[model samples]
Target: MTSDPTSDPTPGSTPDPTPDAVPPTETVRPDWAGIDRLPTLDLLRLMNAEDRTVPAAVAGELPRIAAVVDAVAARMARGGRLVYAGAGTAGRLGVLDAAECPPTFGTDPALVVGLIAGGRTAVTAAVEGAEDRTDLAEADVAALALTPADTLVGVSASGRTPYPLAAIHAARTAGALTVGLACNRGSALVAAAELGIEVEVGPEVLAGSTRLKAGTAQKLVLNLLSTAVMVHLGRTYGNLMVDLRATNTKLRERARRIVAEATGADRDAVGRALGATDGRTKDAILVLLADVDAPTAAQLLKASDGRLRDALERARHQGPPPA
Candidate 1:
């Protein structure tokens, strides 16, 4: 980060946001001259070694990452959604993370969303310089009917991308919680977000090609952000993913193991309980613990606001007050 938080080393948010600020060359390399003669395997080895350093860059942002998790968790508890907005590779990564939330945490599809400039088609194909437009970012969020309770995360490696920064500013205007993630220090993208996480991984091995170390760093940070938020939302019981949606055969087996592990029950017993309760592990646990039927256990979960421990504690302390 720059010693002066107000100064943006990136473009768009700064008055002197010239092309020099976060120059494209910082992330890209001229591969045509040297790559024509080198062995493909040698080039692959160099890329792999560069990719290995991304985790350490992410590790440096743990404190900022925790702040994002806490804020996102609070917003979610209030019925606010988490929205990831970006352009280019950063935008696609946002989409990827949001797409995974449903099966991993049993969250409603709308609860976590992603918006990229140029829309869904842009995810797989370049949309002819879409990231340069600032207005598109604002328009996408407006279409979502954004609320103050929502949290918007903007991703950009250069920290100067017009689309992501514009969306962050717009999200803030709606009183939503905002987070900006970039790979450059004192980025305009960071300045726009209420909480900025800049993981400076330095220049890429391939000259200015950001898809190298910088892209890896952003992916790791995003993984931490979403995973931590899920943990805070009670999606897990101890180390077990009690709320995972078992869609495929492998996942069903994983779910059975989770229930058995949590309850100290055999696979047959676990399967029966889970089947009876519509494959809900938490509900099955409540039924097993309270010695009650499915509906009764479900009502307890509802009354306790879906907090498993609280529901079970209330069940245990019933029939009180002998005067």
Candidate 2:
């Protein structure tokens, strides 16, 4: 809980604990806290119930999440990047969200970057002296020459991680839009950003180990942030990933299926269209519907700036090509 600067910690009369970095130890415990004594089935049920709370907690923050997404989409539409910064579980979540964007929405990797305090090594294994150093976060953001147009999101379960907050502060200083995602209400991290998203998931199941509910909330929030941002950027067409890059056998097959699904065409027809456009779904769709080859389709896509609907319409209805 937060308090006024002049407020006392005691109910009636002491110093408030608002400045604390770690969550305080609680007096009350869950009835099933003593796990060693519980039956296996009972323990599993308790865990599942706790897991179910995560989604609800995330749902409560949708309004704030939507605001952040609109700001991010506006910046990206102007040609700026989106960057994620965090530590530990939050850091890994940031990295995972950024990594998945390339394959899922077909964005360039450079468009969305994730920076963890301990670098790539901290992703799998723990690294000491990482999150404590805000300077490192500051330096990383500084080196990127992050401009006023970019969007920087900092994730921290505790709401007090120095590294993440420092990144947020640096991004704001550089004139970029900043967002802070934390699991505590009225967190300092939240206060640091122009926009704050706090998902109150309560304390962790494991005492002092925030990797439980806090991590779950962070994961869910990150998923929403990235997915919503992608949708706003026009990466999806009619609920389908029409711009996906067919880089491998699996993705190639998935791309074909997506084309067939989105175009209401047969698998054979989809394959022929895909072949004509060299495996580009949007291009192939235009080629089939407009009876054009890859170059003409690509030119049409350029004319429409990657919005498949506009490209297809122009390809079918536009005046003769310019001399």
Candidate 3:
């Protein structure tokens, strides 16, 4: 039998025989018997077919995901932070999402946080019993000093994992918005959080290996949550990532293309606008489109709260900030 990836049960330990105790993600499918005996191509096909079902499972939870997105956006607008906490693959995914926000949305790294159960060490290697340690979860949360304006998302495929469940409780107690992203129905994590998102991806191709379908489901929901919230918070301008940080050569080129596309400016004009605005794509677009100087574009964007659309409308109303 395939062992649950989230936990390290004692060697030769028998699974609890209670039917209700077994989550669908852990239930072994009789049809998948002798999957190892199949040819390599057939094995690949089986896994591919299973992977295709993840999107639909995620779709089934869109309403819940939307609710969480709206709530997170509202909180973040009020100076709240978004925090993700989990263990193992779930924890790694949370950290990955949080790390991308700075480059993707030009957000402060501290604005979105990811906390794994075993801390930094667990990120690269397993830490025995870390998932079962509720104290670690509480301490990690305490360090955040979370307030009502904050949000903590507990990610756990099994739903019953102690780490994320503790995180949800801790966040809720602090009056922060609590969201549980889980793969099992009627899970403790879902029921405990103020907002619950359960994307039932069912059993994995390898039976109890939640890192397959369950991980995919969590990732899809997380992408939806973070991207939608960022959009609502004015991180994008008409589907363009105007606030992206051009920290690398590729991103710098992308910034130039963004400015040109947004303003229909020539390459030279785009380069000049970007130069004038200190390489800020949104400011460059405003400089080209609003017929304003770089400093005036900065002031306009500041007044409009970094929203390119709002700044443009204000620039039109004010008529290019005098001479």
Q: What is the C-alpha RMSD of each candidate to the true structure, in Å?
A: 5.5, 5.9, 3.9
**In candidate 1, what are the lDDT values of residues 1-323, reduced to their tens digit?**
11144554333233335544554327445553475467999877777876787788788889999999999999898889999998878899999999999888888999999999789999999885578667778889898888988999999888887788889988998989999999988888888789989897876776767777877887888888998898887776776787789898998888888888878888788888898889988888877877777787788877776667777887788621122
- Each candidate: how many clashes? 6, 0, 0
Please identify which of the two predictions, 2 or 3, would achieve the higher lDDT against the true structure: 3
Runs in model 3 deviating more than 4 A are 1-20, 319-323
* Consecutive 10-residue window with the lowest summed lDDT within model 3: 10-19
Candidate 3 lDDT, 182-246, residue by residue in tens: 99899888899999999998888898888899999888888999999999999999989999999
Q: Give the Å error, residue 258, model 1.
A: 1.2
TM-score of each: 0.88, 0.89, 0.93
| Worst 10 contiguous positions by lDDT, candidate 1 | 1-10
Local distance difference test values of all predictions, in order: 0.81, 0.81, 0.89
